[model samples]
Target chain A: HLDLHHYLLLSTESSNIRIYYCFRNIMKELQENFKKLLKTERVPVFLTSSGTGAMEASIVNFFKPEEDVLIVVGGKFGERFFKIAKRFGLNPICYEIEWGDYPKVEKIEKYLKENKNIKGVFIQICETSTGTFYPYKEIGEVCKKYDALLIADGITAVGVYNIEFDRSNIDILITGSQKALMTPPGVSAIIWNEKAHKRLGVNKRYKYYFDLEQEYKNQKEKFQTAYTPSVNLYAALNEALKVINKIGIEKIEKNTSIMSKATLKAFEEINLKPLSKNPAIGVSAICLPDSIDGNKLIKFIRENFNMYIAGGQGHLKGKIFRLCHFGYIDIFDTLNQISAVEFALNNLGYNFDLGKATKKAIEVISQYKGA
Target chain B: HLDLHHYLLLSTESSNIRIYYCFRNIMKELQENFKKLLKTERVPVFLTSSGTGAMEASIVNFFKPEEDVLIVVGGKFGERFFKIAKRFGLNPICYEIEWGDYPKVEKIEKYLKENKNIKGVFIQICETSTGTFYPYKEIGEVCKKYDALLIADGITAVGVYNIEFDRSNIDILITGSQKALMTPPGVSAIIWNEKAHKRLGVNKRYKYYFDLEQEYKNQKEKFQTAYTPSVNLYAALNEALKVINKIGIEKIEKNTSIMSKATLKAFEEINLKPLSKNPAIGVSAICLPDSIDGNKLIKFIRENFNMYIAGGQGHLKGKIFRLCHFGYIDIFDTLNQISAVEFALNNLGYNFDLGKATKKAIEVISQYKGA
Candidate 1:
């Protein structure tokens, strides 16, 4: 029910070359704009309905049935990719890590050295499961050395941390509409380099909607899609892109880095251990004291402050909680979250300095501003 | 670019249940508000993309590869269905009608009686390509007698005409966000009765994104979708529903009928032969004299007067021109269009009356009002 004017602004006239135009241009645009902002190389192009869609596209296009893939599982999103890969009939070799630690690149390199005919290597840039950021640069090199495609799910890192797609030579980089893009969840994108494209060219069709070749034809021909697109969502992404473009990508990365340090510093001041000793560059997953019930703590924060901080997913569930410092959020939002957590903890019969989190957040932000 | 407020005001909530609520409640209110509105049992549903998406879903779900279908071909949309049916491996029996004339139900019945194994019938309620509306009720009854599903493309008719889906026993009805809905082109709605549902349940897994089963699961839970949906488009649809609720579908239908007749009268007054004796209840298609060059005439009107009249599509291309008497256009818009056409024709070296079209338009509207 979007207005004609809204569409007229965001919509490129369906490619002028043909009458059918792109069918899913609106959905594609949302993912494309988000990826562009994240500095993802315009490779391995795919558009799907969910974050899982991106993961599925990567597996289906890259692997034949029963083909082997190495899933470096440091957190929830990593496990999700592994599940999705198995669903597509891939036999994944998972390298599991502790909730708060990155999957070791050495272990991955060792596996690749021994395994023959490896289909791909899967890893998450920032694992939402336990808030761990893997050593993407290192793992990317290892995957390259072994001649296996490095498939990175940059779902949580895309808009917040720097992801050098070309520099890292990432074969497949997947992301979604929500999280750092500041758009609502609905669309996902997968960017592939030349090698990935060549492989996809020879693959058989597994699904119609997630097919990259058709999506590419639709976009290149008319800046449209193969099916009806969600035009209103496209309009929202267009507006959000303007904001991101004006602020510049480097500035966004720097802001998130500053916010993450400040958040961690605040937790340190309160004597709470961060989930990961070497915390992810963007997110700070804090471990609530064992005496504290995380589910109750989460509910308390939501009810009292109307803030939605994510709980640990899957294996890390109830052990650690996450604080997102992503797109459209700044120092003020970070400060607010810190204060809300402090209030909830204090109300739940815990004694702590009321201004501890905010003070550290402001101090870190000031230091970063000076730098 | 659209003003952000305009975008906000024209949007709908993207959640599926929220959309269902908006649609059902708006239809309910429209019924109570309009004095002449019929209580159609087929309540409209909202989809996330173009009207074609809705039509495609209908075909993919209701018919298997071995089934036979009757395709009523008058213009592009009718022909489009034929193509889609073929793609799905259905042998579509073509019941051809001239671009501007409504297909004869008797002819269709004769074909149905002769052809065994026909499982479904596809018809365009308003042929957008040439502005003709088929006799849906008669065709529906014939299909009923033969126990075949009657699928109607009502993309251009839903908000403009009184479609009593219950009384007509139309099995599947498709409509779009644009056209008579006065919304941007993104979402489409496919409304089906019990028979069509059973048919869909038996269809093979042709697509994931377009899968009806997943959509049903998503729709039933949280009024969301199997994948990420267009949140902003949902918002826009929600807003449009409010406007429709106030106008009532009956008044909207009556208004379109009156406006349509007025335009038709204008054509007659100018000595232009009506393209169809039994014209569509919504739009007027005027066939130009061979000397006039309909395409050039349409161009002149669009360029000089900034009035966009559609040129004929497919076989009728460059031969006939059409004016929509659909949503968001009224007496003033009609008058302006007629005046523009008259001016363009005269300027293009054709002899025509200056005020005839506007006068006839007024008279027809007055007659409808008196009735």
Candidate 2:
């Protein structure tokens, strides 16, 4: 299938007229569909890079230099906001938390109350590094009470969960083409409310490429971007988003939840412990015993079973492995992942029930009736 | 073809280990082939965005705040450099020139002599906005003599022309995937010599997404990027670069030259004057008669002939139209463009000989047989 698509569209001129026209409409329609999916009136701006680009765009456009912003750092993605804010010369007050923990609304409120100049609170809805699903809705209420904008990185949380943008009062919501969107990476989407737009008024410090205002203006006027966008990627994303919309966000959420639950259940049957204190539905981080090598286990699974999963990032390396149950995945995929893990563990000389894990996963997944 | 590839590989998890492993080798091989195609020892850094991202990466990574740089502004891209430098707090001296005119090397030398603190000279090898190709080799010499870093935006130049990176003394050279690289617009490639790398030794102003040093380090260590790249785009780019390598750069240059010649000849037959005095080989900017509206002409071609061409940008809008003969384009495409223009003009009641343009085009394109 990859070869087929590559043969058809990959060889065309990058700026082909047909592609430009088709993608222009695709981008416009995609944004509209994204608004519908988020149940928001605010239009999502499509950026031509990864989720990190959207994160930086939000910081650079909405906040002023040296303006105090509160960053809730629980995992790697949370740390990203801190780094981007610092790079943009924003005064970021880090509200640090443990890697696998979630941010508390009270703590965020305390930070806001103590710091009168805090203009915004930056955080991740799902910290992919540790598979923790943060309570952004509660934090949003705190930010609202303090009149501080809430910028949530929903890269891993958007399509996997029901992210009602307007209802949740998220001023700036960001996501990427990868993750639950089920498209290849390259484009990121950022949807912000009028309050965030007002805050970004007349900003002149942003570089040409990342200038959100200019991109917004261009997109508004011509359904185009500030730079040459990836037309092929846009076409791919349009189709992916259409599939998600057809499946309905609620169904997707339920499916992802079921998969996550089944996978966790299977892991428990095999005596594997979940790593995150508050794990997200899209991925489950399983803590490996100190005696077992997590890296070796992952490598063995990839080599022997032809299955791939994530290893722990940063400080948690070699101690945990991540199993994904995100977009384009179903119960069968979850069972496969569990079986692979069981096989890998047994191959690594760890005592684990081989067939018991898959059986447990199947039992849990069998209860799901909704499509 | 696009459907096939999309069905197979486009739906995979972006950070999947198998995808990561496969694309890591693809990225490495693509860069190696790119270096060979450029015939330079300098390594090209694969950036996960459009060329504009690469342009910003160069500025924020190499120059410090309030540092002085010289920008030769002849077209929109040149103005982009000016804007980026200002955003990074650099004091940029704009050496302004007419949009269609090329910059003189002597003038650049004079500016460098007068401005002793100028740290770098930024210019575009082929400014896409006006189709003007500057004499970068001469400018590189001037920069070398004055000990100023030469940063060239080669977005529309690299694959279309034989740009000798090392011998030409170019400190920094940048290109995009959408232009001559024959790939979708997502990734950008930047190749720089030791001088530019040494200048970027310890700069930290760039955000995580655009941090060139970290990206370079990561790529050098494990053939990986600092971010999750678009795996499908990389696969497509690797294949495209392999094709380019097989054809050889010199032959591609000749083919592009023939196409450009054919286009210009066709334009001349229709009594349309070339807009740029020193137009690049990739595109031709044709001045429209005052009686005929350029925008209407372009729209007519799009609506009637179903062809895609560019109209004049910025101040030149409604005055000129652009004809692209860039990557993945051939003599047949050039003929089609000329025919469309002729058809559009004749249909719009502009008096011109029918079939004359294609005849003139064929006469010029027939001389090239190397490809």
Candidate 3:
């Protein structure tokens, strides 16, 4: 389920020490790397979930049922925030954007102005379904204007982007271990600034196991989790974060940017069009030609190379495919995927030059001059 | 903190299948083993929390704040149930028993008879602190008489004891992964009969992440957890349970009884008294002489032999030491620990016959004729 390298896998093996090790001490080392990578001094609490749990955590812990929250929906994850909020008795006002379109800051500010009851705003840094990264900082500022907390689902964004959370008005940032953090699924993190911590103690409705107050008390005071976390993933996260810091987050982000650029350029070299107007740079979403079945193309790639390129979710299903250049994927890996897609499309009778996409991918990769 | 074998460790190393594998399929195999081991047809739902979380889950899901619950407190874990119940606003009517003492079934019946509002009964099958095993089946019968749900914490008891849950009237049985299950500490399982399942959907207060309805929907219907579980621990648990099944729970319990009987005999050889009247076969609590410091004797054994024999908790601290013969520990391992204790007690100037404990242990172990 996760593309984990041996370095991170070896870290998971050291998790036999969970019974003896200080959970906070392990996080302390990893947090330093997180701070260095994200350029933030916020406290991060790790929960045993694959991003969805943490997303649910961010809502149930911080927002009350009596309060209104504004959720900017670009894709599937946005819908998740809206649903979880509704499930817990919160009044969620959804502001839906096109699947591949970025949520506008002015529209959010207008919503906040019109609805003064909004206590918090939820948005994703990267709408994972469409590979569209929103300008969360701009939206964060809008929430700041209304004195509302801005929670960013940075599941596919955190480690791949050079996010300066200290200055970015985002009060909370959520990430999954299986994403850019390079660990397998089952561990998710919620990094919050002082604002989110103030709201943490309130709201007890259906919130025992993921209770932030208990988590804050145990994690901050006793150096442990409120519940038993996937201790192996913490070890894996520490190792992965170390790798990110060693290669430098800037260097990793630079590489991801190169890969993303090359991939989009390569796909465009063929007749396929880029799906997102504001692409995430962590992943590329390309619209498949109606002639070729997206599922068939994905299956061919999976069966041939054992690599997963996701077909779309929701209404976009069978119309587009998401190519992930995120998380430890080098330029050569991107080229191989681009070549695979080209080869598969050609064999399926979709008119395209066989080697042109790979040639264009190399051309885009050669243009990178960053250190 | 846990004594794990290499077999379980190797099992944990195969857990790279979180995103793709059907969570239900994994649990289906495990639930079958659990059914055979516990001799029950009840459903076992695994959560990514240690035993305490499951205890909190028991309180939050089944009983509401208005409902009175009888909690039989003998030691630390029993106190945990009472506290979790109180914290969640459940009226926990505590029936306190002395450390190293069993909870009387007549007293529990007396309490249940008086408290008509009591909706549930909570008790540990074995109190790990004092190594005392309560008559949980008797307690379950009392609950059945009163029509109250019986929740048993079988943390260190389950695989060590041949429990027949189908006939025992235990509505809910909770166990930790690190205990007799032989996995690491990140996962906990809660098995429930039909009676407990009927009440699970009623409670919603402070129960989001550990919400039973959500878990039931996903684990029972969807074949996955409501949230991401520690996939590696589940893999490890499957392997550990397989080993338990192969050896057979009856055989494991037989070995445990033999080990317990031998160790108690060995300790009694040196005038060390076994603490509990109804001692669990899983572990032994021994009262050290007033002249010997429990901490020093424990420290000496730990430093010299790298063996950990825990000093007591609460009033028993410095007065007794608990010896665990639980999990994957074999006869020779029990003998080694007995010999270490004898050696350490002598070094601390406690007058005892050298090697007599080992001799007595050998005599007791030699008498075991069970296959």
| Model 3 TM-score, 2 decimals | 0.88
Please give the DockQ score of every candidate, comma-separated: 0.16, 0.57, 0.25
Ranking by lDDT: 2, 3, 1
TM-score of 2: 0.96
DockQ of 1: 0.16
Q: Per-residue lDDT of A1-371 in model 3, one digit per residue for the tens?
A: 32223322332243233234455677678667777888876667777666887887898889877689999888998998888888677889999988999899899999999999899999999998999989988888889889999999999998888888889898989988777877656677888888888898667655666677777677666768866666656766777777778888787888899899888888888878888979998879999988999888877877777766778889998889888776756777788888888877877789877899999889888888432
Task: Give the Cα error of residue B300 in candidate 3, in Å.
Answer: 3.4
Which scores better on lDDT, 1 or 3? 3
Q: Which stretches of candidate 3 lie over 4 Å from their true place?
A: A1-28, A204-206, A226-229, A314-316, A346-349, A369-371, B1-28, B220-222, B274-277, B288-295, B313-319, B347-349, B369-371
Which tens-of-lDDT digit does each residue in A126-222 have in candidate 1? 8876777778888888888899998988877776766667776678888765667665445566787787777874446333445567777666555
By summed lDDT, which 10 consecutive residues of candidate 3 chain A come out lowest?
A: A2-11
**Which candidate gets the maximum DockQ versus the true structure?**
2
lDDT of 2 at A160: 89
lDDT of 2 by residue, A1-371 (tens): 24534523664745465676666787788778888889887877888899999999988888878899999898899999999999878899999999899998888889999998999999898999999998888999999999999999999998889888889979999999888888888889898988888987444775568788888887877889888787777767777777888889999898899988888888888788898888899989999988889999889988887788889999999999998888877778788888888888888888866789899888888877433
lDDT by residue for model 1 (B310-334), tens:
7777767777778877766788888
Ranking by DockQ: 2, 3, 1
| TM-score for each of the candidates | 0.77, 0.96, 0.88
lDDT values, one for every candidate: 0.70, 0.84, 0.79
Instruction: Report how closely model 3 matches the true complex, as a DockQ value.
Output: 0.25
Error of 1 at A169 (Å): 2.7
